[model samples]
Target: MGRTVDQEVHAAFVEFRAKEDDKVRCVVYFCLSVQCIYCQQIRAKNTSRQKQHLLECPGLRGHPNAPQPSQPAQAAPNGIGPPNGYPGTPNGPTATPSGPSGPGTIPAPNGTLMTNGVNPHATPLQAPLQALQNRAAMATPVQATGPPSAPPSAASRPTPKPKSKNSTSSLPAPPLDDVHAAFVEFRAKEEDKCLSVQCIYCQQVRAKNTSRQRQHLLECPTYLSVMKDSIPANNLLHTFPEGDVARSLQIPAPTLELDFRMSIKMNPKVNVGAGIWGQREWVSFIGGQWAGRWGKGIVLPGGQDTQLVTKDSATNLSASFMLQTVDDPPAFIVVRTDGWLTGAKDVLEKVIDSNMADGVNPGSYKYRVNLSMETGDERYTFLNTLMWIGSGCRRGHEVIFDSFRVN
Candidate 1:
């Protein structure tokens, strides 16, 4: 111990005594501070173990008699140079302490040492010694001045790891069987070839495919929690109309045949009084002729047309009449026609200027009519069950109509 005694051992033993082995050999040696009574009790075999015990020993830390580096000569347990008052070791040159006054002395704060309890004047020799002491002190290790630092705080510590992308903690596993059952139920209820499916959780209709259905079951918020249970049936019902589907499914378009043709003669125009709806007019059917694959017929005389010149400048006509075929036993057919007439004013004026004898230009005007017929005759009963459409035009003083049955 050069300046300070080992803190784990008795200071008096370290300063004054020698090792038992060294005394037996007549070789003088200071007591070994590293081999202390406390170290012996714990069997500490090294300097590090001795220092560790010193740090934990309250008696050494708080003792009033503990060695102080400030009193260098008094605190030196082993002499600074060699054993038993020698100034040098057996294998080394003479050694001396670097303090201002020489070996076994401590320097004061201002790099000067006191001799005989009085301050000494600065001299060249003392100045160099003080510089050497300063360098040696700087090279020494510094002791901790405060308590050990607390454990690192949470904010300063590294963050915990994140969960994996494939983790299933937040989402439940999909219920495949329930989803399949829902699809089956939907298909069974629908009657169309292009099927649609309903979401089991929200009852929303979707395209008939497995991927979309499974996605709905797994990710839909309403059904995610209860995927294992059967979803209640919804009230949605959809069916394609049988007639429309049958019509659409036809491969080759069906052709229509001419059902019949009619030629009617009209009486002179009769002026019906104008009213709020429009100007009214009438034309009486004096007689007519009709023929087709069915036998030819005569249009009866009592038929008449009630016409309206509507405010929109269009002509609307309603006509009810009868026809009697020239068969062995003639059959009488009652006909009702509802129609509209439209034309360019100049063309209609030209036709009117021609006095209804010769018709307007063929493409300049159009007459569209819908017809309904009633008859007790067995031969023409098929007309009652079919749909019919007709187109007609005026030529001279008569109107000719060609009607076809929609197949």
Candidate 2:
């Protein structure tokens, strides 16, 4: 309390001389002058700035007991006094005190006299630090007359692009030919770069762009409605009568998957001389075995094939047989088929002759048959609704064939 330097402040501060009104001007420390005893330079009489100056001061920095700098306030650091100099001092370097001086005794023409002594060595560090500080202050000219630059206004700033509403933006545009086929193009004005197009279905008019036109067709109410009511040319529904309920159905095309293979053993043909239609012959189906995706079975004997041979040697065949599944309670299925065996006249002659048919190539002639199956067993009843087609080769007394189920 008796005019001692503050340990926290770590600076030499002199008491403020009150005005004639006896009012204190400095809010903090109640002091108006601070002469750094180490650097012997007058600093701005601010508590925080003075502390900052001591830490940055060249003379104080080397002192063992020098205070470390603390976080400073918004005001500038008190490295040196303001540009114009402090009160009682002119616009130049201060008259540094050489030793202890009596209170109120001015040391030089331009220096503030402290109520205490100034160390003689303080001048050596102050000159170099002050010159460096001054140069930095001159290099960066701070504006004191105006407020800081404000941020850009909403209207002045660039607007960010909007995200796409749907992924359709990435779709490649439809071709020009496709666009013209769907929409009728016409020019609104002779000089217009964009031609106008009218949808043939909805008659809606819009700018002619292949992508936009195609997208319009996809979303157009009238066009979608028309498409719903129309049937594609390749659709099997077109085969049904116009007003039939089946015509409105969405049916898939029939596909065939191989079901089984079978070798049918047959007895010798019984020739029936030429009838009103053609040369007729009868052949009886002997025993045979069959296997497929559903089950394995044997072809029951006693089935017959009645054939009519035309003059050109194309043979028409009608056959019927029975199949027995190998289940615990064996299921019996009825199999019936009708097909043709046609080839060169000589080829057919050899095919119809058991002796020569063994030597003929199956590929050299076509023997195809369409078959239908019927069963009373509930376990195998699904076969009753399906149809099969087979391609066969006649080898003397046996016919081997692969049957495909029509899916």
Candidate 3:
């Protein structure tokens, strides 16, 4: 029942030591929260930078150049309570006590009570060590909600809030303040480097132009910004095909190709062994109006001459021919008329999207032929008919020509 003076002193020292430890742990948690918030602000600024540069950022919304995020603003440095009228920040800002710094926790000059900042989840034995250590620490509790096991870096920033599935997945874009700042920086330098682009309209001779102007023109009437899946404006280079007068036309059509090689194999064979033709006089195609347009051609004679062989009466009168792709596609498609006996002249000009094409003129092409709507009921042999059939013609009247108007 008796205790020595040395034992008594040791017991008292241990009690004092425990009180100080609790304070230290509290300080650590408080500092960590401050750091996390600081990091978030930094990241928000960085996102704004990327968006303004037109760098592929999926998060920036509203505009590509916004500054800080519209979420909660920064907390006070000394962990003071929030100011009145902060619309979205959490409340309980003025509560100086992090966790029940209540009765008899060491008194301090500022009559405010500080909490014991203990993570209640600490093991039972660890709690005593924490309580003793925290006596000197005045750490604040962060109202953070998430996996505590994760490190501060992961835990700091709020996760991208789940978006409505039905809504478009694109973000609203980064804040505009930062975005414009970045955009201004880019614009200042982008103009220094310009490239030459052919004018689709006026068909001016090629010359160097500013890429800056072009980039800025993403909002231009002629300049269309493709969101997704649409044809890229750059894919097409527009210029007048050939003409003395410059036209105010702009045809920015993509390259056109006839996929005969692939389509021929996939489709069923055409049955050509059984058709018949009516007899008529075959004539040379003379240039004249056909299908309401002037066609380029020479008139011979034509009226459906029934024959399988090519002859003056056949080839001369009817100028129907097969096509072969010796060059790039969009061969001009047009329409025209033959002069005499409706002159066995053929027409091709039909598909000239006037809106898209500038300075288009009066001509069409099939086998590079310059006629439209061949008349006189005479037909000429298809020269490279094999390209379409994938084999020799089975019979004279069986194989038919597939025609396309070139641009």
RMSD in Å for model 1: 33.8
Candidate 3 residue-wise lDDT, 1-407, digit = tens: 11222222111121111121222221111121110111111111122332332222232234322233233444567776345322221332322223455532432223333366443433232233345445524444334222223223323533323323342212223244423322211111112221222223221111132432233223222322222113333244763333212222232564322322111111122223322432233222222211212222222222122122122212112234312222243122222312211112232111112132122222222112123432222232221121111111111112112223333
Which portions of model 2 show Cα errors greater than 4 Å?
Answer: 1-251
Question: Which structure among the candidates has the greatest TM-score?
Answer: 2
Off by over 4 Å in 3: 1-82, 85-93, 96-367, 370-402, 405-407
Superposition-based RMSD of candidate 2 using all C-alpha atoms, in angstroms: 27.0
lDDT of 1 at 225: 35
The lDDT of model 3 is 0.26
Ranking by lDDT: 2, 1, 3
**Candidate with the greatest lDDT versus the true structure:** 2
TM-score of 2: 0.43
What RMSD does each model have against the real structure? 33.8, 27.0, 23.4
Candidate 1 structure quality by residue, lDDT tens digits, 14-33? 11112233322111111122
lDDT string, candidate 2, 1-407, tens digits: 11112334532443222223333233321123445655656643676676666557686555654554433322236555333222223344454423244432325443443333232223333333333333333454322221133223223533322323342222234456756788765543332233455677765655455665677665655655454355453254446664454544434568899999998999999998999989999999998999999999899999999999999999999999999999989999999999999999998999989899999999999999999999999999998889999999988899999999988
Ranking by TM-score: 2, 1, 3
TM-score of 3: 0.19
Task: Assess the local accuracy of residue 199 in candidate 3 as a C-alpha lDDT between 0 and 100.
Answer: 26
Model 1 regions lying over 4 Å from their true place: 1-256, 311-313, 351-359
lDDT score of residue 21 within candidate 3: 21
What C-alpha lDDT does candidate 1 achieve relative to the native structure?
A: 0.53
